[model samples]
Target: MNILRSPPVPFTDQASVSERRSNLLDASTISPAGFAWLMLGISVSMMLCGSVTFFIGFMLMPWVIGLLMVFYVAGIVSAISLLGRSIICNALAPPSPRKHIPDNCFFCSSLGFDN
Candidate 1:
């Protein structure tokens, strides 16, 4: 009933298969010197990145401080300006009128109080 014949698969015993896998794993394992070199490369790259970031932060510190200082001065100036305007407005505005009572007031006489 087969239209096309397929190649036969080779059978392997459990012991031989395990032995071959172990040999492959042993061959692929890294040597001590290679591990040391890998660690050295990683450390050098990390140190370079750290130094670059530190330099960038150091360079930008002055600008950041100056911006904060500008904002603080602007806030102080705005507060002082508002205070001055309030004082000037109050000084220029007319005084509130005061109530005057006549010396011979009828209300006081009716209340039996002598002026």
Candidate 2:
């Protein structure tokens, strides 16, 4: 007896091109400096939001407190998602061969390849 096969899911040409571009972007990894900048921005924003929430809570504004709580949770979720994406991108891209070199190595120094 032969097993029946399911039909393939169909996507538009535009969607196929978009999917390819998305894959390529997903495969690409950002530099350490870029990653640092992104993290710094997220951290600063989180801190600012936390401080605002604290101020509103201390001021005894119930509505503001509730709004701040919602905003804080959303921010945390977004930060976690961003971090997950960064990790996945880093994992998908191949590791640099020079990454294993010691800081004091002459080859790494001469080549300026300390990534």
Candidate 3:
């Protein structure tokens, strides 16, 4: 098994970011600490890989390591932000006063209007 492989995609690569985000938040993908676990795994791998490269005298530049670290930090932060978002979808939204106000006859109701 490839230890370095990223967290399994909850969505297809063909999907847009919003679609993937929604997929990640869906019931099928929701794990209380899933994102946290994935982040931890990725961060640990990054640290280990960077350390090995630096100590093994690979041609890796110090600036590259610094830039990678910055990217890693930003990635983790964005992941946390995404995990904190509400999971509500447009189709699954909570009913509101406006929702029942019947804006479109075709879409607002399933029952045929006599009028």
Candidate 4:
């Protein structure tokens, strides 16, 4: 089902590399300090929630709740790792799932490709 859609514009490759680079998620767009701080905050919050939930489960003596919290913690941790990896992949050269990128672009060039 579609609603309130705008017309699609034609894709063009004639834009300079610098311009296309903005369209892509390159290292230039991220602040490493921000990334580290975000991860740290996520880790701290996850630990706090997991510990509190586990403590409650222990006090209540429900074995299943403890197990559920464990799984929840694991799921969030994995999700965060995956999201981070995907973001990093975007910043990497030879960015993910793009067609018609030059064979001599930064990604290939950084990986030691020469022609």
Which number leads on TM-score? 1
Runs of candidate 3 with Cα error greater than 4 angstroms are 1-60, 85-95, 101-115
- Give all candidates' CA lDDT scores: 0.79, 0.75, 0.67, 0.73
If scored against the real structure, what TM-score would every candidate get?
Answer: 0.60, 0.31, 0.27, 0.33
lDDT-based ranking, best first?
A: 1, 2, 4, 3
Cα error, residue 10 of model 1, in Å, equals 14
lDDT for predicted candidate 2 compared with the true structure? 0.75
Query: How many residue pairs clash in all the candidates, one count each?
Result: 0, 0, 0, 0
- Regions of candidate 1 where Cα sits further than 4 Å from its true position: 1-16, 95-115
- Candidate 2 vs candidate 4: which has greater lDDT? 2
Tell me the deviation in Å of residue 86 in model 1. 1.7
- Candidate 3 or 2, higher TM-score: 2
- Pairs that clash in candidate 1: none
| True lDDT of residue 72, candidate 2 | 99
lDDT by residue (tens digit), candidate 2, 82-113: 99999999999998777564678888878887
Please report, as a residue range, the 10-residue window in candidate 2 with the lowest summed lDDT: 1-10
Worst 10 residues of 3 by lDDT: 1-10
lDDT of candidate 4 over 1-115, digit per residue (tens): 0112332333886767666665453433446676677788889999999999999878887677788999999999999999999899878858467578787799888889866
lDDT of 1 by residue, 1-115 (tens): 0112332333655557667766555556667787788789889999999999999999999999999999999999999999999999999999989998886898898898875
User: Which one wins on lDDT?
Assistant: 1
Q: After superposition, how far is residue 110 of candidate 2 from its true place, in Å?
A: 99
